[model samples]
Target: MTKLAINGGTPVRDTYLPYGQQWIEDDDIEEVVKALKSDYLTTGPKIKEFEEKFGKYVGVKYAVAISNGTAALHGASFAAGIKEGDEVITTPITFAASANCILYQGGKPVFADIDSSTYNIDPKDIEEKISSKTKAIVPVDFTGQPVNIDEINAIAKKYNLIVIEDGAHSLGAEYKGKRIGSLVDMTTFSFHPVKHITTGEGGMITTNNKELYEKLKLFRTHGITRDKEILYNKNESSWYYEQLELGYNYRITDIQCALGISQLNKIDKFLRRRREIAEKYNEYLKDIDGIVLPYQEEYIKSSWHLYVIQLELEKFKVGRREIFEALQAENIGVNVHYIPVYYHPYYQKLGYKKGLCPNAEKLYERIITIPLYPKMTDKDVKDVVEALDKVLKYYKR
Candidate 1:
């Protein structure tokens, strides 16, 4: 018998290796410390600095910083004019927030199937799901791979619908030689610790349209604007401000923005390291019998966020659960990237049932997100591969 960790044998690693992590250094801390000592903590200079830097990086005209990625999505949904009786189409394979943003605006979420090869929402599926009520398409850049933006854009133009790309995993990704944030009507990003850049818990929406940009700003700050030009009553009074409409307080603090600015400065280096790690994984894992590596489109340059691998279930006697446990038993913190959005209990109660997205539902049964991050050492990458190889070999049919 091949002694295995899951069956009480020696584990491959002494400590657990998490699936994702952040890389923060002295400068990142110093930036936040500077903001902390400054007069403005919440709405301050660092916020604008970060926004401008981010917009320039992504080749966009404006960027609105907010509390978190979900809030970014909600802000975009609001800016897109989603309302009662509206329908938004998105992939079921992404985080629940992708679909939940529609619900936040009193709009119905229409689930779409994914392309099995790329693991992104298929344009064909989006087209099939469209209706007179369909107002927008929220395509997720699943695992840092940019979705087929050109095709999706064509569909949106045909239907006169808005495109809000969920680029939470694709901070530095490019599509057809252009940056992700440069495309579509609006694009949203997350700055969670595990993401490419970390602001602790933050999000942003980038856009080229001035109307959407202004709307996003309003939605981020309780719909209040101090600008004399737009306010109903031209208030030149220094203390005067107006609540133009109903909106949420999704403001991101200067502290987080300070960290974001610092993090953004290092994003290229971080992106390179992430890509190196991903390339290392691909080089070693490609020929592994039971493992199916994630496919990359030739035209899109991926940021390589989550290195998800799908099990060729027929190659192993055991199921995904057994293999997942076996990997965990070896001190590897492997995780599943997502459950189809509609599978959650809340969505289920909303009458979204199973079989809503056959491809995504099928994918959920086989996918596992292994560790890949900028902070990981070469040895850490090797350890992950060795652990996977051992576990899969032991379970081979």
Candidate 2:
């Protein structure tokens, strides 16, 4: 197996301390193993159990589990009634799925600028992008930090728009004391290995609207409904089902849901450890003149999924690439969170250009995601800080 090396000669502290990782304990393994032993492996009791538990955890009335985050977004978009020629306002400083889901539904994605401090979608910019065709606003909770949901909601209300929060990074995050999943009309979560919790590969959509919830249930499974009561007026019979609309087979297995239930048990501990690591990074990097630490807004509680630091280019001798490579030489495992969504080839083909979102474009040039997860120890954190400090000193202007 290949190993990541540090400075050519020095060995990395841990060969597997990725930027983010799944913290699977014995319980998580046991749950999955137990599910495998059960008669129902897919579309079983555990899947519904996990959905109900997750819904309560996030304070949402309904939760629909799917194959992955992108599927969750697609389902949510479809349930929200997004269609061809519709426009959706969203931030560019996010994973492409936030915008691509719009395109998947034959809708146009209008890029919005980000907040300079939190790097979340700025509501003002979202408002400026709205038009007659605007249908929804999908604000990503970047790096586990909750976007300004109340402000975003105010804008959405004024313009009669739907809010589908891309909460892939914010399963346990809160905004203004309310959990993130409950704040918007719909919220999508990722259970990828790098997220706050993991189910190997899964996603979920949460909503309070019963109609939308029903629609999501159908959309996640080929729009087929087996509800006997809904299918027949009085002569409800077995084997009777209805294919109400078009949908996808985005159902997740019970094995994954079992693991998700197990992981949810330790979410508090996981979030606490992640925050501890983030605090350590903040303490160590606060005095560094050329680094801009992530700032949490007063009303939001972040899940600390990624500890991103932005470089002050004016104070650095080299650009982002040079610093990123230097960190890699030290086995720091640093990476950029995202390039602006509009900068992608597909979006450019749709008439998007540079300078469309000035704040997002500016952020792309400076931001880098440092190592962050629940398993890192104090020694690991110190080593990362020391390595970063050394690299910056060697390249300082």
Candidate 3:
């Protein structure tokens, strides 16, 4: 057998491959340049154009652009009327921002366990977490896979709670013959560099309810509105506007919107390439011992923002950290998707104890994020698989 890289043997590749990255084309740069030369940079025509196009893409009536994905979540929480004592249910196995948005509105973020197979928030756990204080459900499309939306929606309807789909990882993903944004009360997307699409740093919230749309817009722009009909001082001058409520300055720039528009134009092609890469990974990693491949449902189409794998620790002599380091030694840029949100020190200080989400905590111990982007070559995919096989086999008990 070939020697392991962790033992100072030959590595898989010379260059480091990141777990994720953005793909920028020439047209994307041209659009940004045009926006820079235009009259406005923050509140320009490009913002509206991007919003309209994004809304149409998701089959939603309205879309509000924000400074970042976290801002989008904050806007959604504000629009949902989250208050001091209200509780918003979300999964623990996600970025802190997913749950932090609830705290921003002075609401409590209730942690729900994830389904081991899909790494998504379990609908049954969501229902169990609901209480008299529950006001909204923020189910994340973890690893670009759509959560059980139909069941979550039914639960929300039964309890009269709002549904804010955290779709930061699933821009082009589909669910039950329809896109994700259209299926929830409010669905938020990210345009960070590593997301499915990039606007440098931006976010969007899509909704069918005009009321929610208006609230989202208000929250995005410091709770200010200049619309004649909604203005409290209708008889005031044309320049007059009102601050209806306290809000944040979460507006995204027009330059970024221009980039977003350009990126949006190629989302389909990018999504198709991502699916192809995922298929290749699935085929190569399926029979490998000491690993658990990601699971996908037949009915949904995943955008695959991340390609995460779970190490079968029992089959290996060393722990997860050792295997992770071994893969890195092989020049494979591997990273962990998350450590449960509640596991953070801040959450612990706020009285959130460990063991709240057993499945998420357990999964966190074995999960590692592998490279998955549109720009990756087939050789890059193969190298990643071979590196995993080598490390896992080397550490096999």
Candidate 4:
């Protein structure tokens, strides 16, 4: 008989393993403590230090640190001049923030179908979705896999549209030879705990354009400008500042920047461990008839934010939810990456209907995000593999 954990058999793991987690060290703690003891906690020296360090890391000329990833998205959208009547093209298979930023500026979000294999936005679909009102493209690097930047750039150039890359899952990722933050007009990153590097909660926007860089700075701090050149009045006082345009008070604290600096220092180690875990999953689950592993292209290096597996229902007697529950019974904390954004009731209320993007809808039905993090040992990976194997065998058709 095929042993199954849900049937009261011994689980593969005695302890629960979450899908993802932050790996904090003593160094991280020390940095936070140092920041806490310093004279300035918010809008301080560490902010500049962290921004400069991050800019150098990503090979970008400027970086604007913000309160969180969603605020980073909002700042990027504002810098791109995405406003009323403008439409931003993006994929449906991403977090809601990717599209919501457009709405924050009174713009419409045009959903594009994803490439079935890479699970990134298809450039062809992007071109097909462009209308007269389409002003920008917000392509997400879903699961740390780089989108086809070359094609996306060509499309943007042809239509004179801005490109804002959502690099939330891709901090150390590279496409061809260029880093993710360097290739786009503007790229946004998140520092949530589950991400590669944690600043407790923070985000940043990286850009090569000086004008956009300056605009992002103003946008992050309530559109206030103390710069002499752009001020409407000749206020020579150092304390005098003016609100140049409407913006948000989305400034990140120095404490977060200190933690970010510490986390950034160990990014290469974090990336390497994540890749190792992904490679192990590839090796062990390659031949599993009912499982489809993530596709990685040779030209791109993924950050491996999440190890997603697709279930082939034809080879299984049970459904996706059943498998999910079985994995949970085995002490594995599996989760879904996303539901198609337009399928949400809130989105549906805005006149978005089903069949908006069939590929993304299909993906939502089959995708499962399993445990993958730097803290996991080889034994942990093996346990997850064994549990998955048992569950699949028990439910095989």
lDDT of 1 by residue, 1-397 (tens): 5588978899989999999999999998998899999999998888899999999999999999999999999999999999999999999998889998999999999988999999999999999999999999999999999999999999999999999999999999999899999899999999999999999999999999999999999998889999888988884687999998788999999999999999999999999999999999999998789988999999999999899999999999999999999999999999998988888899989999998889999999999999998999999999999998998998899
Model 3: per-residue lDDT, tens digit, 112-208?
9999899999999999999999999999999899999889999999999999999999998999889878888999999999999999999999999
Q: Which regions of candidate 3 are displaced past 4 Å?
A: none
lDDT for each residue of candidate 2 in 64-127, tens digit (9 for 90 to 100):
9999999999999999899999999988888899999998999999998999999999988889
In order, what lDDT does every prediction score? 0.94, 0.89, 0.93, 0.94
**Candidate 4 at residue 68, lDDT?**
97
Stretches off by above 4 angstroms in model 1 are none
List per-candidate RMSD values in Å: 0.9, 2.9, 0.9, 0.9
TM-score of each: 0.99, 0.96, 0.99, 0.98
lDDT of 1: 0.94
Could you tell me the TM-score of candidate 2?
0.96
